[model samples]
Every structure is written in C-alpha cells, then in structure tokens.
Target: MRKIMTNKTSKYILLLICSMSLLSCEKFLDKQPNDMLNLDQVFSIRLETERYLANVYSYIPDPLVCNGVNYTPLSDEADWVFNWPHQQINTGNWSPVNTPYDIWSKYYKGIRAASTFINRVSECKECDELNPGITVQYREEARVLRAFYYFLLIRQYGPVTILPDVPLAIDAPLSEMQLPRNSYDECVDFIVSELDKAQQVLPDKQSNTREYGRTSAGMARALKARVLLYAASPLWNGNTDYADFKNKDGKQLVNQVYDQNKWRKAAEAAKSVIDKMPEGLYKKNGTDGKFDPFLSYQYVFLDRWNTEVIWARPMTGDAVRWERCSAPRQINGYIGLGPSQQLVDEYEMENGMSPFTAASTTANPVINPASGYTETGFSTTATKFTKAGIHNMYVGREPRFYATVGFNGMDWVYKGADGKTIIRVELFSTGKDGYNGSNDHSTTGYTTVKYVHPESDVRNGRHVLKSWIFFRLAEFYLNYAEALNEYDPQNPDIYKYINLIRERGGIPSLPEGLNQDQIRERIRHERRIELALEEHRFWDVKRWKIAEQTDAAPIYGMNVTTGTSFSDQNFYKRKITESRTFQKKHFLWPVPQYEIERNTELVQNPEW
Candidate 1:
C-alpha cells in the first residue's frame, strides 16, 4: 500500500473533512483550522462523526454511469458510439500509464477512509449517550465497506496491497509505509474475515428507510459469496500461467496447484446467503394475478428496495443522463448505447430453445429449426408482446428479451405532447433513431431498455427515482449453482436454484440429466442474460478464463448503415460493429504505472 507522507496527510484529511461538511450544513458544528485538533474535533461530535461515515460511503462507484468505471462497453454486451476512455480498452490501446477505467487509486483511498472511520468513530462522545450502540453499528458498517472496497479492487487488479485495519499515520517513515502486494489467497482470507466480523453485529435488513443504503449483514454475506466465487474460479485457483509471478521476497502471488475444495467453499458460501437472508427473486403479478415474468424482471430494478436487491445505493448520481443515452431520438435522446448482435442472439425463444445452434462470422447465424427464429422477414400479425410488421428475429422471444432489448420498431411508452402516446422507434438507415452517420445514433440499430424507465421523459425533465442495485438474490442462486456443478455435479440443489431464475426469466426449466459440462454452459448463459448490463459480464468472463473467446471476438450487430426503411430486410442482417483485442494479460488490469513508480516493492501484473 502506498502511504501518504507527512506533508500530504493533512491536505487529504482536510479535503475529506471539507467534503463531509458540504454534505450537510446542519451536521457540521463549525469550520476548524487544518490540524490534529480539527481532526479530533470531527470525531468528538455525534453529527460530525456520522457525517464522516457518510463521506466514506460516497466512494461506491455508480455502475450505471457510462464512464471509465462502467464495464458494459468494455465487454461484448454493448458499445458506445462516442469515443469514451473505456473504449480504449477494447482496441488494445490502453496500458499501465494509459489505463482506462482505473479504480485502483480511487478504491484504495476509499479503503483508507473506511479504516480511518473504523479506528476513530469510537471517540464520538455524544453517540452512545444519545443513541445506544450507534457507534458500534457505525464501526461495523465501515468494516464491511472497507472489505467491499477491497473486493472491488481484487476483482479488477487481482491481489492488490491490503492495508492494515489501523490506518498508517501521515508522518510514518517512508520505508515503513511501502508495502508489497498480498498473495491472492491471503487477500481473500482477510476480506472474508473482515466481512464475518461485521456481519456478527449488523442487522440482516435496515428497518428504517433513512438507513436504506447503509451496510447490512445481508450485504456482507452477498459480497463474501461473490468474493469466494471469484477466488474459486480458474483465474485465481491453480492458474499455472502465474507460476513465475512472485513478489519481491519470492512469494508466489497466485496459487499454482488446483484445489477442488475451493469450489466446495464457494458453494457453501452462496448457500449461506440463500438459507440465512430473507431475500427472494423479485416478482410482479399481472392483471390476472399470475406471475408476470416480463413485469417481474423489468420492475426488479425500477421498483425501490424490492426483495431481490441484496445491496443497493440510494437514488444518487445523474441517472437521467443514462436514460437520455439509452432513449430513442423520437423522445429527444442521444441513443448512443446499443446492444450487440451477440447478446441479442443469446436470448432464447419462447419455448426455451436457443435461436442459434452455432454462431457465424457472416451476417447469418446457424438457426435452430426447433426454435422457429428467422431473420429474413417481418411479422404479419400482432403477438402478445410485439406489434405487426416487427422484425421476425425479435418476435416470439422470452419475456426478458422484450424487457431488455429495444429493437428497431419497438414502441417507446412515453408521454406525448398531449400527455399520452406510444412513439414507435425507427432504427432503419433513414429512420429517427437509425445510424444517420451521426455520433448520437445507435450504431447497432438497437438501444438498451433494461435500465431505462418507460415513462421517463428526458425532454421534459421527468425522471424516475430508483436504486441502482449492487448485489441481488438472483446472483447468489447462479453462484451457488455454478460452484456446486464444479464440485458436486449430481446435486439436485443445482437444478433447483437454476430453475428458480429460469422461471422468473420466463423460460422453461433445464431438462434433467445434464452432464457437468452442459450445466456449466447453462449457468454461464444464465448469468449473461440475468445480470446483463449490471457490470458483471466484464469481470465474469475474465474470472472464468474465457475472455479470449468472448471479449476478443468481433462485436456484431444489425446492419445500421444499409437499410432503406423500417421494414427493410437489409437492416435485420448481422454485421460486424466493432473488433476487439484481448490477450492473456488483458485478464487482469495492469497495476497503474504511477503506483509502481511510487512503491518500489509493488510489482506489475503479468505483462503490463
């Protein structure tokens, strides 16, 4: 861990203290001088201490934002029409010095802040007197948050330097501050142990609406499950590629021997969450009082504090900006974010059969005759979900497909000039939201509808308020199923959990008697569909050691440049939208070059 020297410690602390004061004017008692006295004053008052904790919570990244931190454009799931820094990664134009989506320093700073709060919050003189056990709960929240930040760091950088629970003093000797990166297993153990400690004191759920986004036992357990799952994956577990990768003292950073027991540990971790937490797969009932899969899937995100969410931040950040980028041009939006053809083909038909028996390099996919999917024509009649003359390829698909993908002719349910009208989106060459050789259009002739609210009128400043879910119950189910299949393939619990997600996704349950390999593919595909655009696919492929096949491949989409009209067959043809480059080194992000320069003990990742 790179330590802040004496000269810079005061500046960093002052900045954080000032930011906390800005969060709420009434909470801060007074402005103080920048010194040790001011630092002590912050922890002396109850409101000031709570405000400092809030500052620690502010570092949680907004995955919904289409910035460097966002992973959707970095993966094959989607593309950004404009030139964002995250796109630099797809073209192999980034490095340690020019790293895009770099959160190494950001999260380390968060970890430091959390440690500081954890160590200092006990000094609050008024907290215990005013509210018994409040300071203890606050300290536990900071502990879980610190563990979570470490989890985020390891997921991207792989085996980062773990700081001690007690933050180093600003005036610590330079030699004492420089630290080498911890081993992968050591880091995982430290994070899990911290989460376990926090979970012992935190509540399973926050009953008060005011504490909505605060850390809970459920969040700690969910994060622990995800961390264990990643540690058990091929990237970290017995990966021989890092055999020679070592620290300054010749300590192997990644383990070099396979451990089947790791998978068992991961399965047990996920099962703990399922058995202990009261969360379930969120559902919404239709007009007939049955489980409406489409609404159930769509509103899981739109609905506030639903049972599905294990952890979520309060409705903060500019969610309206994301809605604007995803909306069609007819509703006065940018329409720059488009789903790829590869993702579109991943959705199953109504009967739960995949549309493609095999993927193709050409415009045509190897269609599965049993699935009844076609690319050559339009629908002649209206179906229950789609309208007449819509592309045949988009029709008769699963409920999640309609809930997620905004096709060329899909209706935009928005308020009209008279306050009510369904505007049809036109993504043909000459249509409203089509690729008109502009930066604001959808390059793939499609837009993402998963996170965009149907009634959000970006033109009129009407935005819906909803939490950006960080962890959910569906993820643990898939995690349990995947881990169980690796260690105990014959376990009936595997199919039971997978079926729960499939049922909510409006698809049929898996056929019995699937072998281990078959079940692996099903679990991966389910994750891709269920957790789409929630910042999971990017890390998932890498952890599974399959990014070379998925991320390195050419990104495909509909032919947005050649179509003449809304119903043109040429527009429905698959075309290469972007080409990506992914090498073995791309699996883990490079340690930032500046960090390497600052700490001689710190080593760079494999090739960077």
Candidate 2:
C-alpha cells in the first residue's frame, strides 16, 4: 500500500543521523536518498516533505512477502514447499545474530525518519503554502506512523528505547545516544498516547483513491487496539518468565504484575474502533449467485477497499512476486506455501463443532466420522455433495475449509479451454500438485488457495494487483471479544462478537451453557479460522505463551506415498512433515547480536 511520491526538483533530502551508540549506525532504509541539501531545502516544500514520509511508509513490511521469513511458515499454520529463510527458526535453530526477520534495524531506521519529520516538519512554512488545510494532517501521519513502528518494534523484540519527540542530531555524540531500553509499560503508554493524539488530526477515513492507504483515524485506533491487546496478553502482563529480565540499569523490561485494567483498556479501545465501523463485518451477497461464505471471505481479500478493510497496501499491475511465492507448482508456480494439517484441523465442521473430538496424536486423529468425514474412496455425481466426483474427506466440511485448502480430487475451476471449467486436482502420487519430483509441490497435501485469486491465470503469468490488508473491522470485533472476556470472565458480549464472525462463515453460533473458558476456547478457534495465514496466528501463539505446546510438535500432512492411484488412495492417514522445537525462551525474540555487540550498554534478551 506504499506509493512513494517523487519530485523532479529533488535538490536534496534530509538524512537524519542514525541513533548514537544504541542504534546500529548501519544505513537502513533509503536513509540517504538526498544528502547534500540543507535542512531548509529538504523540509521547506510540500513535495519534498511528502516524499520523505512516503519513503518512511515504504519500510512497512507486507505479510506475504518473504524477507528472512515467510509469516505462515514461521508458525504452526503452514509448511513451505520450497526452502524458506525461516527454516532455521521453524526448526528452533536461530540465535540473536541469526533471526528469521530482523526488525531491530528496520524499525529503528523508520523511527529515525519519523522523529526527524516531527522535529523539522513545523519549520517548513512553504509546505503550508501549498495546502494549508492538509499540513497538520501530514505531520500527524508521520507521528502516528512513528508510534506504529515503535509498536512493531516492541512486539518483535521485547523492550526498546522510546524515541517520542526528540530526533537524533546528525552530529550528536555517540555517548548521548546509547540510551537504555524503556520498560514495557513506558512503551505502551507512549504508543497509546501518540495514537490518541493522531486521531485528532488524521481524517476519519481514506477520502478517495488519491488518499488510499494513507494514515487515518481508523488506522490509528485500530493499531492502538492491537498494541493494547498485546500489552494485556499473558506474555507481557504478569509474565514471570521474564520477571528476572532487566536492562543493564537494573530496570525490568517486562511488567511481571498482572493488571486487569490492561485488559479493560484494550477492550475499550477495541470497542471504540468497532463502534465506528458502520458496515460491521462484510457479507458476501451483492454478486448474482447463491450467498456463499467462501466467496465472501475470498473477495474480502480480492476486492480491495471493501467494507471490511481499514488499512491496506494497494498495488498496480500484476502481483508477480506474490503469485510466484504462493501458487501451486502444477500451475507453473513456486508452490512455496502449504497449509499444515495442524491448521487444516482447526476448521471445524459446518455445525460449528470441532473436527477432532480428541486428536491426542496426529497419526490417529479422532475426527468425527459421524459428520460425513470419509477418508478413502470416491463418490458419484448423483451423490448429494459439492465434491460429487471427489474424495469424501474434502467434502461437506466448513466453507472456509473449501475456500482455503486445495486438496486432492478437489474441483479447482478456473478459466480453461473455451470457457470457465473445473479441473479436478489430481494429487494422487503421479498427479499434479502432490507428486514429489523435479518441481516443488505442496508438502502438506494442500496448497493455500485462500489468497490466490481463482481468476488469476498462473500459466500465462496473468495476475491482478491485490492489496495487502493491514487492518479490517472483523479483527477489531475479535480483539474486543478477547479483551472483554479477559477483563470480565462472565461477560456475555464476548459470545456475541465471536459468533458474529462465525455466522459470516456459515457456521452455527456458539451454543449456550458455556463458561468463560469455553467461550475463550471458541474465540481462539474462530480467530485461527477467521484470521488464518493473515499473520496473526504466529503472534497469537507466542503472546498466549502456548508456543511450547503448538510450535514444538511435529507438523503433519496426508500419507502421499500411500495414495498411488485415484481409485484406491489413502487420504486420512497422517504423515509427519517436519518436527519443530520451541522453548519458553522463545516467548521473546533476541535483540540481534550485532546490536548487542555494537553497544555493550544494551542488555541481551534472557537466555540468548
């Protein structure tokens, strides 16, 4: 969603000095785009200042993009068909120096840009000359973006030095910049306060296509809700695992005492955003066809700037890189991403019930055979089912199941021949997306069809520019439901919000007679399904401190070897794709070794 504005009259640009000793002086960001200009020349005009903020926004990472890590692969949500940069971390092999993704350098670089903008934007009267009405709005954007970067920094690497208003001088002494990391509470307070201030200046929404993907009142509040949610999570609030964790100054990095008010604050912030979403959750009905939850969910991503999206990155032309990374190998795609069976099982039955009555082990997954979950054999066209000519295990499941995972024998209809036609996914050993050979195929027996546009012609390299959604209304409701239940265990509103999400997915609402724990369990289930591969599950598992249980287990897939022929194939048998490891120390990512080595004053995260 980042489009950097350019100016042909680019005489010079502001290159703020990297933070003294604490921050790596290594140039990150396009840190020195235009360096020869004086301060007055850089910030004196509207075009120059606009270009500065645009470059800062460029630093925001998209979820699906592969850096050192692919989001889905890092979590238990999926496995990669191709070798991923994050494999080391996924297999519990990363150290401080060797992380999946390094946020320390990236965000600090962004923070420097933002802090510089705030400190110098006011001095630029020429910018106000161009458009008086929008000058303050631009400044507020930089501020809110700065706070957002801090929020991002703290989430990945525990506590960080809070650079609120003061910008680092290009010539500042190294000693003056080697500040210690702020306490968890301090960083939270600063971010929440900044977002509150930003709301007053930013517009209520993106005004039009011209202002699309820019900072807005909704984005600020939505981010505030997210920051608070993490703050109140068990990993941050009352987390004794980091109780002994302190900086070199002896100040604690994480808050050990559990505070109920944190959850209350999170709930209030979430509700505030939820109240503003007049459209509420998106419903898929406008199209001329039967109301399908699958299409609705699919189009929420496909149709950018819909009722659900609060913040997104709109791209033009084709999404070539995205398609190459996630598409199926049979379609001349890289086939890098495969939804894991662990995630596949999370999709409940159509009745809104758990698929596994009790799956203590993946090998003998106790799926409810009563719900028409047949593993082997094929059905006929006259058989009352969506997958009439497909395997029973892939049919009659939740709408999201069909919308997300592409399984063997599943009818994958796309533009073909003379008109649109169905091509059954023949993943039976010698079949297209399953056979192991020269090409990379799905390791999990299923490739993610959720993000890929059904109309996208991977064969001809045809693809539409898709938006990377950062925030949406549905997440706020989920956030509100989670926080409310944590603060008031018996809160009835929790069930309403969670069920609202489920109803859109064509699943029945939660039945009555459930307690707080039951409600929370259902909410977690809904989040996994509703927000799968959206970059939330990975953070949720960590913040909930349940990674030891979730990430440490072996990943599962179908018994691909046994499925040699379509007529006689093995479907339900589970095969261990890969074993993962997660220790309690993994709750927080280590501050990079380079950062620690540069400044001895900086304290490393525990057990690194």
Best by lDDT: 1
Please write out the lDDT profile of model 2 over residues 3-56, one tens digit for every residue: 232332121222111111112223432453356776678887665666676666
Clash pairs detected, candidate 2: 1-313
Residue 267 displacement (Å), model 2: 0.8
Per-residue lDDT of model 1, residues 1-608, tens digit only: 11112332222233223322233222432433224546589899765676677678778877666543678898888887878887788999998999888899999998998899899888986866665566788788889989999998999889989897788888999897889999999999999999999888888876654446778898999999999999999999999999988998999999999999999999999999998755578999999999899999999989978888888865433556688788887778888888888788889998999988855433567888989998878899999789998989999999999888898888888655566668888888888777773568887778888877776677776767676789899999999999999999999999999999999988999999889999999999999899988889998999999999889988888888877777788888778899889999999899999999999999999988
Off by over 4 Å in 1: 1-37, 358-364, 416-418
TM-score to native of every candidate shown = 0.93, 0.91
Please tell me which predicted candidate would have the highest TM-score against the true structure: 1
lDDT at 289 for candidate 2?
A: 67
RMSD of 1: 5.5
